[model samples]
Target: MERVNVVYVLLYDHSEERILMVKNKGMDSSYYTLPGGAVEIGETLEDAAIREVIEETGLSVELDGVLAVSEAFLEQRGHHAIFFTFRGKVVGGKINIMYPEEIEEVTWMNAEEALKYASLSTEGNELVNRNSTIPYVLRGKVIHKN
Candidate 1:
């Protein structure tokens, strides 16, 4: 199976009440997620987070710290994905969808509303809620059935 490394940035506005999110077009439907994407070869995780946020949301951010490290197996896809979520602060740029083909919209949503609509597991939602400066790990397994 292929191993994929992805980075996501959780950016909040000045008030910290709202978070920057992207509505992405999935294979079957659309879903809400934090601004981020796959890490390219030779790129560090932190650089990938900053670059992804800029590419997906048209905003530049300085990551404050790592938030969570999540792992999952995509059985159907024959892949294992490791996701690194970082807490970031916007330093400049306005909200815009640079990659229209993959992203549907870029907007800020209240924390509660974001968690409600986000395509994340219950534990994932809780991790976001914690907002801990110390990083946490969430491991998940894929179940295969006959």
Candidate 2:
């Protein structure tokens, strides 16, 4: 079985009512996505999210907490992505392109606007609504493996 592990951060600015997101370097070109990526061996999920955010957005984050855990298999891509999503607060570093290889631009958008651009595998409405973690899944078979 092919397995992919990634960490995504949801950076919230309560004062601004916005979230920081990245325009990702997609398979074709790039698409806007929550700042995140694959976790390497020996790295904790929080560390992965922090590293990925810095790599893709040039920012350091203070994790607020774990937000969600998601897993999905893409039939077309023939891969499974197990994701750890965390709630984060921007702590330091300027907002810029940290890695030109995988990121194009960064933007801050409110929940509504973000919904328009993000191809969210999981619904963020609850994030907007209850401000809590919820189990989320996308298309394909879901297996609870130990």
- Where model 2 places Cα greater than 4 Å from the true spot, the runs are 14-16, 116-124, 133-146
- Per-residue alpha-carbon lDDT of model 1 for 29-123, expressed as tens digits? 99999999899997778889999999999899988777778888989788899988888899999988888999999989998888676545687
Candidate 1: segments with Cα more than 4 A from true spot: 117-130, 135-146
* Best-matching candidate per lDDT: 1
Q: How would you encode candidate 2's per-residue C-alpha lDDT over 99-127 as one tens digit per residue?
A: 77778889888866775554444555565
All-Cα superposition RMSD per candidate? 7.9, 6.5
Deviation of model 1 at 119, angstroms: 6.1
CA lDDT of every candidate: 0.84, 0.76
